[model samples]
Target: MWERNLNGKDLQFHLSGINNENFIMKDEQTGSWWQQVSGRAIQGPLKGSQLKRFSHDDLTFATWKREHPSTRILEPDPSAQEEYAPADWEAETAELPVVTPRGKSEPLEDRDLVAGVSNQDAARAYLVADLARQGPVNDRLGTTPILVLPFEDGKSVRVFERTAGGQVLEFFAGTGEELGRLVDATTGSTWDFRGTALAGPLSGSQMARMDVLLDYWFDWRTYHPDTDVYRAGL
Candidate 1:
């Protein structure tokens, strides 16, 4: 998600158009168009301006509620209930044709799901299916060591900087009683999906969470042509 406030002005936006399957938001204040993927204003008065990104998690309701028991869900408006997409929207959309002007099919299929990270002049795409099979992954992006954790459910995922207490840590999948948890190589500390060290020397320590965008390969590649594709053991 992106911050609507820019240059000390809170802007209101609405669906302006679609370009290459991405949403283009037009701010009411300046009439500028912003790209959904990059949050960059591409046209009109605020051309070249960027919106500050807000971090979010795309977790399953069960997982989210387990972690945040008191969280309140936003109820859909009753009047707009009929306007909402059906529960099969995703399945239906998968059969639709896609167009990507600046995307490649190599590395992954256009519609493959990917967990993308873009920071510090670097961008990378991690195949979601591979993440489910590989469990927690330890990798570095632009000098920042990171841990990518895929929950047991196989759908939800999270990324965090592995550096904690001034130490770069490596993590592996927990087994048996420790299943669904992460164990760091340095201290054997067990970490929950929240990136918090739950046991061992680093107990109570928290890994810095990083912003991740769960996107399709075509959309990610179209926006980040130079992005690297993560491969197992490579």
Candidate 2:
């Protein structure tokens, strides 16, 4: 997803009515068209401009409430009908038949949620299930030290650069009562899922944020075919 506003003005977008099956959005302000996944304007006055993407987490209402108790949830429109809801859960268990350009299929199921991270030309996808089993993940992307903190439920993740005060640090999964948090090996500081240092010498510090996307395994690999999948041995 991209920022809705641009250049001191809020821009409105609508789906471009194109014969191609690819998803494209057009801004009403400049009449420019954009690719839905990359948020790059490809046609019209705003061509060559890129949209700034912000990080987001998709999680259950209960989990969100526990983390952000004061946050407000927008209520569904009262006029909306039950038919507008999603299809049956059982029907979503299997991957849907998708037709894309030749040689685009990925190795994982289309419905599996993958936590995607990218740096320059290097990109990787960590299966949410594997992260849940392994706890925090300390890895690198193109020489940039990074940390992946997965929620306990395995449905969401938050990524951050593992640098503070110009020093790179390594992190590991917390033990015992500190299970949900991550502890840096160098500083022994514990960080919450949001990358905030909660205790220890570095308390109150925040990690530099990184853009992470949660998408179907197929969608990620389709957009980034060179992506490496995290396996048990990796």
Candidate 3:
């Protein structure tokens, strides 16, 4: 009769009697000693022996004492000791929540990809910010940040406008003659003009205009996670 986490939550694990439950029942008349224990295997092969036919309470006591040797010398009755049950109960219970922080390196997607405005609407933000690896921000728009999002048409880059009380009144990343002009030039459901040439496919002029918008986003610090940073290198 063994419990894995006594007074705690765990499977009803069985440990075959490991030749440890040695009981000595003294015989007063014969002056002999009768070693008593259970016949059931608590663990191991049937090679071990414990005098079977013992009461449940007695068997429980023996296993308890075997696991916690200090309890062997002390009387088993809880009433005899004040708060004994509570102390043992607490010792048996698990308090701290089990959390394993190992190997949790999956890439986290940011729900707030639009930057300032979307960030405000989002209740929580998730981006792995680590200077040791991802490094400080580098792009056309900002510095030392873990995430960036491109501007969707009708939406300009927004830098948050905070008040004295730390309340955000609005967002204003930026808008300009160049920015607005490009917005008009591009055509897409998202107003994300890919800048294909009128002649066909992508031409030098179309690609050039695309670069201008990307530079604006980088300068304003509203980074598009989808955009490649390598383009700036050339």
Best-fitting candidate, scored by TM-score: 1
Q: Rank candidates, lDDT, best first.
A: 1, 2, 3
Candidate 3 lDDT, 127-215, residue by residue in tens: 21221122111233222111222223322221211211222111112245333222211221111122222321222222212112212
Q: Show where candidate 2 strays beyond 4 Å.
A: 17-22, 87-94, 101-106
Q: Spell out the clash pairs found in candidate 1.
A: none
lDDT of 1: 0.89
TM-score of 2: 0.84
Error of 2 at 107 (Å): 4.0
How would the candidate models be sorted by TM-score, starting from the highest? Answer: 1, 2, 3
lDDT of 2 at 12: 94
In angstroms, how far off is 9's CA in candidate 3? 62
